[model samples]
Target: MEPNLILTALFLISAAFTVVTAEYVRPQPRKDLQFPWDPKPSSQPQQVHISLAGDKHMRVTWVTGDRSAPSIVEYGTSSGKYSSVTQGESTSYSYLMYKSGLIHHTIIGPLEHGTVYFYRCGGQGPEFQLKTPAAQFPITFAVAGDLGQTGWTKSTLDHIDRCLYDVHLLPGDLSYADYVQSRWDTFGELVQPLASARPWMVTQGNHEKESIPFFKDGFESYNSRWKMPYEESGSSSNLYYSFEVAGAHIIMLGSYTDYDEDSDQYRWLKADLSKVDRHKTPWLLVLFHVPWYNSNKAHQGEGDSMMAAIEPLLYAASVDIMFAGHVHAYERSKRVNSGKSDTCGAVHITIGDGGNREGLAQRYIHPSPEWSVFREASFGHGELKIVNSTHAFWTWHRNDDDEPVRSDQFWMTSLVSSGCVAERRHELRKILISP
Candidate 1:
C-alpha cells in the first residue's frame, strides 16, 4: 500500500479503539430492571415533586440529564396509562465551573375540587410517580421552614413522611444554596419521597442568593427545574403570587424585593389584600422568606426592617396567619395587638427546624427575651393541620438522634373572623405596630 493509505488505516484503527473504550465506559443499563433511586446516571428523573397552586392547580418539577426529550406529564384517573399529556421544555443550570442536568416542569390547570389524580412526570423520555390529590378547597397542609441537607433533614423527612399532608409549604431557606450547589440535590432527593404524593410550595430565601452566574440564570437550574403557579392567579411574577386554597386566600411574599411601602410589591399586596373579603375566602394566610415577630438574636427584628413597608398592609388587610423561616430554631408568639389582640392580627409561627446545617438558635430578645413563647434547639419538622377556619393544629416533631418524636406541639387559633374586627383598623392589629 502507499504511504498515505497506511496512514489512513492507522487513523481508522485508533478511531475504532476510542469508540470501543467510550462504549465500555458508558454501558447502557437494562431498561426493564432500572432502579429510580440508584444514584447512577440515567435519563430517569430523581427529584420528582409537586407544588400546589392555591386550590385547583399543581406544579410538577423534576430533573434529567438528557435534554433531547420533552418534559411530559401523563395523567388520567389511574396510574396505568397517562391519557392526558402536558409537555414542557428542559433546560440546564450553568454553575460557576460546570453544567448539570436539565430541569423540567409542568403546571396542570384548574383540576376538580376533590378528585384523586394518578400521574407520573417526565417526558416521553423517563418518568415515575404515585397517585396524588389535586388542589382542593379548605385543604389542610403543613408549613415548615429552614430545611437544608443534614441528618436531621433525613429524620424530619421520615417523621413528616407519615403525616401525609395535602401540601408542604416552605417559607424559605430550602437547600441552603447560598454557599454551594450540591446540597440542592440532597434536598431534592429526600423531598421527592413526599412531594410526589403532595405539593411542596415555596418562597425564595436568602440562601438562594448566589453569585451573578447563578442568579443570572434566574437560578436557572433551580427555577427551571421546578414549576410554580404564577400565570393562573394573575401573578405578575413567580417571586410573588396569590392563590385561593380552601376557604383561605394565600399570598406568598418575596422579602428580597424593594418593599418600601411605595414600591410595586407593597402596592400589589395592598390591592390583593383589599379584595380578600371575609366571605369569599374567610381566612387569609400570608407566607414569606423571613419572619416579622421572631425573637432570635441572629434575625431579631430582621423582618422589622420591612414591617414599615409591608406589615401595615398585611395588618390592615388582617392577614389571618403569617409563617416564616430564616432562624434555625422554632418560635411561637402570644397573639398581640398587631398580633396580640383576639379581634385581629395573624398568629405568627417561626418553625424553622425543617433541617439545616446550622444547629439551633440559643439567644432571644431579652437576656433571652419574653417574645419567644416556645423555642427548642433540636432537629425537627412542623406539621400544620387546618382543622377549620377558626382553628389549626401546629405540631413539631423533633428528630433527635435520628429518632422521630413529637417534641413540641400546640393549637393555633385565629380570631380574624367577621365577628371579631369590624374594619381595617383594630387595636390588636395596632399593638405591635412600631410606636
Candidate 2:
C-alpha cells in the first residue's frame, strides 16, 4: 500500500480502538418514591419550601390540613426566637377527585443578606431555617431540572445539599406530577430539607401544563403551590418571571406559555431586558424548559419557534448564559446564536437530567455539531458560581460518581465585562428608548 493509504488505515484502527474503549454507564433503575399520607395535626405545616420574593423578602410556602389555619410566618435571625411576623394568604384548588390542602404563601423578610433566619409556619410544626443569599458576588446557584420524585432525584438532591449553594434554579419540570396532584405534595416534602434552607427559583415546563378541556386550566396546582414573584417583575403570569440575586439578574422564561412576539411573556421579557443594568448586575442569565439548541435526537426542534421569537432579544442583551431542561440529558453549547458559535452569544446549557421518572435521553445525532462543546446522557445537576462581576465558574456533577466529580467545568467571562457587546448595547439602548 502507498504511504498515504497506510496512514489512513492506521487512523481507522485508532478510531475503532477509541470507540471500543469508551466507558458507558447504563441508566439507573427508575423508582418513584411514594410518601404515605399519614394523618397529622391539622395545623402542622408540611411540604415547606422557600423562594426569593424580591431583593429583600423571602416567601415561605407550605401546606396545612386545617382549612382555616392562619397564613402567617414568624421569623428572626436567631433560632427559635420570633422577632418579626408577617401575614400572607392561603389558597386551595381541586383537580378532578383531588382537593388540595390549604396552601399557605407568606412573605417574611426585609431580611439581612447572607444571614440565617429561623422561622415557623402557621406558628406550628418543626422550625425551619433559611440563609439569605449575599447581596454581592461570590454567590452559587445549584441548577437542576425535571426533578421528579425518583431515586435519582434523591441522589441529585443529596449531592446538592452537600454544596454550599446560595440559591437553587430549576429551569422547569419541578414535580413531574403529570396531572397526579398527590405527587406535588410528595415532591415538596422530599425537597423541604434543602429547599427550606435556600431559595428555589423556578419556571414552568410542559408537564406543568395539566390542562383539561372545558373543565380545568393548566398550572392550577403549580401556580397556587409554587407562587413566584411574577408581579414584582411586572409579569402577568406566574409562568414567567425575573429575579435579581447577588449581582446576577436571572430571568426564568416559560416554555409552555405564549412566547410569540406579541405575547405577554415576550413583551415582559423585552421590557425586563431593557431595564437590565449591566453595570450593577454584570451576570445576566436566563432559564427555561426547552433548549433552543440541542444535539440529542429526543425532542429535537421543540424549541425552534420560541427561539425564533425571542432569541434575538436575548442575544441583543448579551445574556451570559442560558439554562434549560426537559431533554433528559446534559449538553453544553459553546456561545452560540442561530446555530453558529459567536463570541457575543450565550453559552446554552441543558441540564434536564435531574432524575425524572423518565429515563435518560441517550440517543444523540451522530457526528456532533460545532456548537455542542460537551454532551452526555446521565442523571446530573449543574452548579454555577458567579465569583465576581466579570468572572464565573460552572460545573456539571453526575449522580453516578462515587465522589463529587466535576465532569465538565470551565471559567466564563461576562460578555459585558469582556466588551463583546459594546456595539450591541448602544443599538439595544436606541431600540429601547425609540418610539
Candidate 3:
C-alpha cells in the first residue's frame, strides 16, 4: 500500500469516529424570508449602544436612516456639560433589494474607572449615562441569548434593567431575524435601552449567518454591526474574541466558524488561553452560541463537534464555567470533562431562556442525562455576580411572575489545586450547592 493513501484512510476513519451518533445539520433558510422595512429617512440617531474598547475605553455605536447625517458624540463626566467631541464613521449594507440604515461607531477612551459619564450622539440627541467598572474584581454580568423582538423579550429586558448589571455577556443568536435583515433594526431598538447604558459584549450565532445572494460568505450584517474586541485580542476575525472585565478573562468562541485543530480559530484560542494570568483573573468563563453538553432535544449535538475540537484546551486551562444559548431553555451541568464528572472541569450552563419569537423549549428527551444538574423551561435571563476573586454567585431568573423569580442559584469557587485536590474540594467544601 502507498504511504500517502494509508495516511488519507487513517484521517477519514479518525473524522468518522468524532461525529455524534445522531446527525445534526442546519436546514437551508426559506427563499422569501424578507419583509418590507422601508421608512422615511431620519437624521436622528437611533439604536445606540456601547461595547468595551479596552479596560479604560468604551466604543459607542448608533444608526441613522440618512447617510448624510453627522456621526458625532458630545460627552463628559458631568451632566449637561460637553467637555470633548468625538467624530466617527458610518456604514450601510445592501442585501437582495433591501438597504439597511447607516451604522456608526466611535471609541471614547482615557476614562476613569467607577465613574459615570453622560453623552449624547448626533450633537442634539437626548442625554444618557454609563459607568465604567473599577480596575479590580467584583464585576457583575447579565447573560442570555436567542433574543428577538417579542413580549417575552420585553419582559426579560425589563428584568435585566432592574438588576442593574454592569455588563452583558451574549453567547449568540442575538436576533432571530436571520432571513429578514430589517428585523435587526427592531432588535437593536429593543435592546438599546439597556445596551446603551452598559457594554453588551456579543459573538455571532448561527442565526446571524444570513446568506447574501451575491456573496459566498454570510454574516455580512453581523460583521458590520456589533463589532467586538477581536482586534485588541490579537484576533483577525470578529466572529470570535476575548476580553477582560474586572477579575475575569471572558473567551467568546464562534460555533458557525471552523474549529478543526489546525483552524485559525483554534490557533487563536490556544494562544489566548496560554496568555491568561489566572492569578489576576481567577474566573475563566467561556461562551459561544451552541451547547456542547445540552440535554434539551431542540439543539442537541449542535455543540458536540465544537466541544470535541476545543474541550481539551478549556480543561487544560482550568476554565471555571462555560455559557451558551440556542436550546431555548435553561440547563446547568455539573463540573464535567471528557463526558464525565470531574471537580477541576468547567461547569457548563445553557441560558437560552431569553424570550424570542420562538417560545420556550419545553420537551426533554426521556431519561435525563447524568451531567445536567438543574434544568428549566421558561423565558428569562441569568445573572453572574463575581463577589471576589475566589467566589461568585450565579442565578437564573424566570419571567413568568410579576417579578423575577430565582429558578436556580449556586456559588462557584476557584480551586487552588489542579488534579485530585480539586476533586476533594468538590466533595468536602461544596459551599451552597444547588439541587
Candidate 4:
C-alpha cells in the first residue's frame, strides 16, 4: 500500500476509537454541607417549620437550645402587629450520646385560607410568615423526596421556592440523618425557609427508621419532631396518616411500618377510603417511600409485599395518583394495577430524586416495562397543579437545566370526574356478590 493510504487508514482508526470511547458523562454529585449550630442565645428559636394540623389549623414547630423556653407563638395578618396569641407544648429527647434541643409544637388558627400570617416562635426570634393553602380548587403541591443536606438538596429546594405551591408533599427519606441526631437539627434548619412558609406533609422512609436491636425503636426522633395529624385521621401511628387540603384527600403511608392486611395502617386506610366523599373532595392521592411500579434497578421489588396487601384497596377506591420514593431516581408509570396498564388504576410516580448525598440511581432495567411511562435518573422536584375538580397538570423539573425545564408533563383527569370511580365500584360490587 502507498504511504498516504497507510496514513489515512491510521487516522480513520483513531477517530473510530475516539468515538467508541466517548460516552455521556453525568454531573458529579454535590457534597453534603455541615450546618453547624451557631452560638446564639439559648432561648432563641431555630429550625422553624409548619405543618397541617386539622381543619383550618396549622402546626408551628421549632427548636430552642433552652429547654425552658416558652412554647408560644404570636401572630397577626401584618408583621410587627400583635393580634392573636397561642400557647403550645414542648418536649425533648435523647438518642445515644446526642441530646436534642427543646422541640415546641403549637397549633395556631382557625386561620383563614389563602392568607399569610406573620408569627414569632418562642415569643422571640425574627418574625416569620406562613401562607395557608387555599380552601378551593386550583391549588399546587411541590413534591420531592429523599432530600438530604447536600448542595443538590439546596438546588431542589430553591427551585421549589420559585414555584407558587400551596403545600409540599414528601414521600420520605427526609434528613438522611441515619442515626446521627444532630443532622436532624441541621436538616430542620436547612428546610426552614421553605417549610416555615408552607405546610410540609411527609411520610416515613427507611432512613428515618433508626432502630437498634435493643437500644432504641425506629422513628423515635422522627415521631417526636415531625408530627402529623394522625390522631385526627384516626390513625394510631404518625408513621402513616391522612389529611385533606384544597378539595383533595392525601394519604401518607408508612413503608417502614406494618402494612399487611391485618396491620393497623391497613385498617385505618380502609376506613379512611370508605369515609372519603368523592363529591366533596373530588381528588384522592396516596404517597409512600417504596415504589410499587419502578423500572429502576435500585431498590427493586422492595415494595411488592406492601403493594400486594394494599393495591386492591387503592384500585377499588380509584385513587387518582400515587407517589413513592427510595429508588434515588424519577419514574412515572401509566395507570396500572397488578403490573398491568388499566385506565381505572392509579398513576404511580416514583420521584425519589431530591438530591440525597447517596447519589442517584443511574441504572434502569432494560426492555422497559409497558406500564412505565417516563423514567430518568436526575436530581429534581415535581410540581402538581390541581387546576380543578376534574383536571390537573403534573410536571417534572430537572436541575441540570439552566432554566426550569418541563422535562416531563401531562394532563391528568380525576377518577371521580372521569367516571372511573363508578366503574371501579361496580366491578368491586360484582366481585363481592360473586365468589
In order, candidate lDDTs are: 0.64, 0.88, 0.79, 0.88
Rank candidates, lDDT, best first: 4, 2, 3, 1
lDDT (tens digit, per residue) of candidate 4 on 3-78: 3344334432111101111133446778998666479898999989999999999999999999989999999999
For model 4, the run of ten residues with the poorest summed lDDT: 13-22
**Clash count of each predicted structure:** 16, 0, 0, 0
Q: How do the residues 1-435 of candidate 2 rate in per-residue lDDT, one tens digit apiece? A: 643344334432111101111265644456888677688898899999999998799999999989999999999988889999999999999976788999999998799999989999997789999999998989999999999998889889999999989999999998977766777888988999998899999999887877767877889999999999999898999999999998999999999989987788888888998888888988899999999999988789999999998898888888999999989889999999989999999999999999887777777887999999998888889999999998999999988753556789999999988797686887677655644
* TM-score of every prediction relative to native: 0.81, 0.93, 0.86, 0.92
> How does candidate 3 score on lDDT?
0.79
Compared to the true structure, candidate 2 yields what TM-score? 0.93
Cα lDDT tens digits for candidate 1, 1-435: 643344334432111111212111221111111125556455677678887654556777777766664677887666567668887666676665546676777776556756667776664434455433433343667777877766566667777777767667888777764534555665677678787877777877776654354244344444554556766556566677777766667888887766776666766666665556666666778888788877667576678777667775666666777888887667776554343444456667787777666556644555444445666555567777666667767777766556666766777655555554457656434543433
By TM-score, the best candidate is: 2
User: Candidates ranked by TM-score, best first?
Assistant: 2, 4, 3, 1
Instruction: Please provide, for model 3 over 237-276, each residue's C-alpha lDDT reduced to its tens digit, 9 standing for 90 to 100.
Output: 9999999988889999999999878789988887787677
Q: Tell me, what's the RMSD of every candidate? A: 13.1, 10.3, 10.3, 10.5
Instruction: Name the better of 3 and 4 by TM-score.
Output: 4
**For model 2, how big is the CA root-mean-square deviation?**
10.3
